[model samples]
Target chain A: MDKRAIGVFDSGLGGLTAVRRLHALMPQENIIYFGDTGRVPYGTRGRDIITKYARQDVAFLRQFDLKSIIIACNTVSAIALDLLSKENDIPIIGTVEPACRRAMTMTQTGRVGVIGTAATIRSGAYEKYLHKKDGTLDLFTQACPLFVPLVENGRVHRGDVVIETVVKEYLTPLKDAGVDTLILGCTHYPLLEEVIGDFMGPDVTLIDSGAEAANLASTQFDPNEGTGTTQYFVSDDPQGFNQLAELFLQEKVDVGAELVDISRY
Target chain B: MDKRAIGVFDSGLGGLTAVRRLHALMPQENIIYFGDTGRVPYGTRGRDIITKYARQDVAFLRQFDLKSIIIACNTVSAIALDLLSKENDIPIIGTVEPACRRAMTMTQTGRVGVIGTAATIRSGAYEKYLHKKDGTLDLFTQACPLFVPLVENGRVHRGDVVIETVVKEYLTPLKDAGVDTLILGCTHYPLLEEVIGDFMGPDVTLIDSGAEAANLASTQFDPNEGTGTTQYFVSDDPQGFNQLAELFLQEKVDVGAELVDISRY
Candidate 1:
């Protein structure tokens, strides 16, 4: 029964979705979230830069006496999770394994589609993970690079032409491949869930990796006594944080975010 | 007649447009272009972070014996140019002033439109510059925050629905406003010049700020004896640099890029 806050970090506002799910799952657990909003969309960057940013993000979180850490970014999880986990003393969890497990249970057919940033799909982390669980599973992978931009710009609506067109452009491949389960590999993908779901139709199960990771964290590390309060920190756009979160969470959240220079960490 | 290279930098590939024009305008002048591709899309972050990044970007370029510096990024031009100029001994040129002077000459209806990153438009840099040029001029400004991502993802070509839809979404307001001249305030916007021109029609002259800034630099600094060569550097994506440059330039480019860690500066 630990009292230290759970540290959760993402490249940007995507991790707030994870925080939402985690908050719902364990109302008594204290949470600290770090969103590197200044240097986001880690999906489009090189592995070396992603690894460097991921380390700095974790280092910032480590400033707190954290009970555990969650890497809500698929790019970080794919590129640097193993290295981060190995270095950190406490339990360090990434979105990949939990999301892979969730997809396995949700898929009736062996066919599964993974959509994420370029690095995530390029790394073959999801394919590698699921194959070890069951070699017979069929996987189709696509890197929806523009999805983060679409979501970041608040184009995550059903009827918006840009979002709809981009979603169709990316998901049509997975849809045509006839995969019944789709993994929203990047945390940002969940924000565009409605547009993606509408395009993919009702039969396809969309696995929210960040949410799944939050659920996994809820099961593993128990800081049994906590205040249940959530503190948010971002590298930039502190004023826009609450508005962005409310856009994703669908509620008026009065939580104020403190600006932290993650680069200094 | 300085022999030193003219240093040009952007948050990302956008600055390469300035470099392209500079290379064309002054073939004998040595040029150093730095694109912070590792942490691109500086348009959305807060002013403090942008200032920090802009300083670091200039600092990286300052490592070379530059005769002059060009801030090809409208966000940096809008937010950090004055401060950067004051801090450095070399003459500093930003996209805003040169583009403003060009737009003043092109506007037949005394109506001009400016489109760039959110930070650029929000900075009101263009508005202030144009107003100071001619107070009676009718000005319309729009923040096309998604333009960089669209360009970065290689969506600059015509007939692509995504780019068309986005262009229409951003430009329709300016078109309806009856703008006679449009400023491509961000470097990334010039890559989508064809689609933008197609949408805005023939009469509306589109001003490429990066190109104009490059032209301004060409006039100011001679750099008399160079090898007629250009060297490229990026914080990330060394492999993708030439390919991206080619897409924007419409030529087969073979210049290999060297990677630099900009944050270290």
Candidate 2:
């Protein structure tokens, strides 16, 4: 049984949703989370830059004796996970494969809709993974570039006009395709589930990638071995991250985040 | 007479607005622009991180024999201008001082409104600069955090429901305060001028800080010194910047952007 802490990182606080789920599933496992708040919103950026930042994020976590590393960010997972897994010895798992697998099981109609940042949708990572599992599976993909900013700005309420308008603009195409299973392809996308779900109607099943990834991590480790310790680290102002932590985790972050100069990595 | 190119940089393509204005005011001036596209949107980040990025942006421009340097991004101008100006021997000018000066001359009622990113409004740089100039002047400031993302996503058309809703939400406070002159404090705001202008109505004179900064730069040197050459540089994928350049510059960005590894700075 590996007793070491599990390392998790995201472009920003969105990864904490995964951590919250991880805590629920494996209460005793020690978790160390790093949010790259300084250089965030990786979904809108280029693949190479995201990959570079992901490497730095992994290196920062590698300093700790981690049982495993989770790429909680969908953007990093889509763009950098293979490179990171190949380069490092530690077990590195990205959200895409786990969540795709979850969707494959959840979908009865073989019709799946994937929504994420531009790079993620453009990379077609989710579709590729799903196709590899079953070539007959039908996939519809949409890039909701503004979703991250909307979520980050706390505009995810049920009746928010802006959120509703933007959501409709992105999801209508997927809905038109008659996709029964919708993948919240970005970590931050889960925060806007209520609005997205309302638009997609009650009949459609919404898959939370971060939560699925957490569940995937749960199966890999022995729950009885850990100490239940959790620490938060960020590359920007701790004060700001501390204030926004609750928005992501759905509870006040117990420990104040410690700031680290991530550029050093 | 300085024959060297004038340097201008922003966290992203928003500074191209300043470059566009510079081209108009001084048609013959050679301009060198650097947009940190890899790590754009510094306005939402902490002061120290903004300062660090501003330094790297300046250092990248300093490599060329520059006649002067312009901090076209309002966030960097608000947070790092004074520090950057003091640290470097080259003439460094930020948009705040020039825009504030312009507003001073334009406002007949002495009531001025300022709108920008969270960091810019939080820093109170425009208010401080305006107050320092005339203590009796009344100022109303609002932080429009979503504006940058909206503009970057190309949601700037007049009567666009999302743009109108966001504009009203951010501008109503300023409009209620009865400010006749409004300062588009951030460079990106100028792109949404039509939507913003419609919301504020015809009487409220909108001030583009970026345009004003370009005018200010034009006055500092002889027009005949430059050869009408302009070049663009970015920290991330040039192809992405190349696609978005026209949105900011109004015209085609001739000679595609050159990539620079900004972390070295």
Q: Pick the candidate with the highest lDDT.
A: 2
C-alpha displacement of A17 in model 2, angstroms?
Answer: 0.9
Task: List where candidate 2 sits over 4 angstroms from the true fold.
Answer: none
Distance (Å) between predicted and true CA of B253, model 1? 1.7
Per-residue alpha-carbon lDDT of candidate 2 for residues B101-185, written as tens digits (9 for 90 to 100) = 9999999999999999999999989888888889999999999999999999999998778989999999999999999999999
Question: What does candidate 2 score on TM?
Answer: 0.99
How would you encode candidate 1's per-residue C-alpha lDDT over B11-92 as one tens digit per residue?
Answer: 8788888888887888898888888888888998889999999999999998888889899899999999899989999999
Off by over 4 Å in 1: none
lDDT of 1: 0.89
Report iRMS values in order. Answer: 1.2, 0.7
Looking at model 2, how many pairs of residues clash?
0
In order, the TM-score of chain B in each prediction is: 0.97, 0.98
Kindly report which residue pairs in candidate 1 clash with one another: none
**How does model 1 score by TM-score?**
0.98
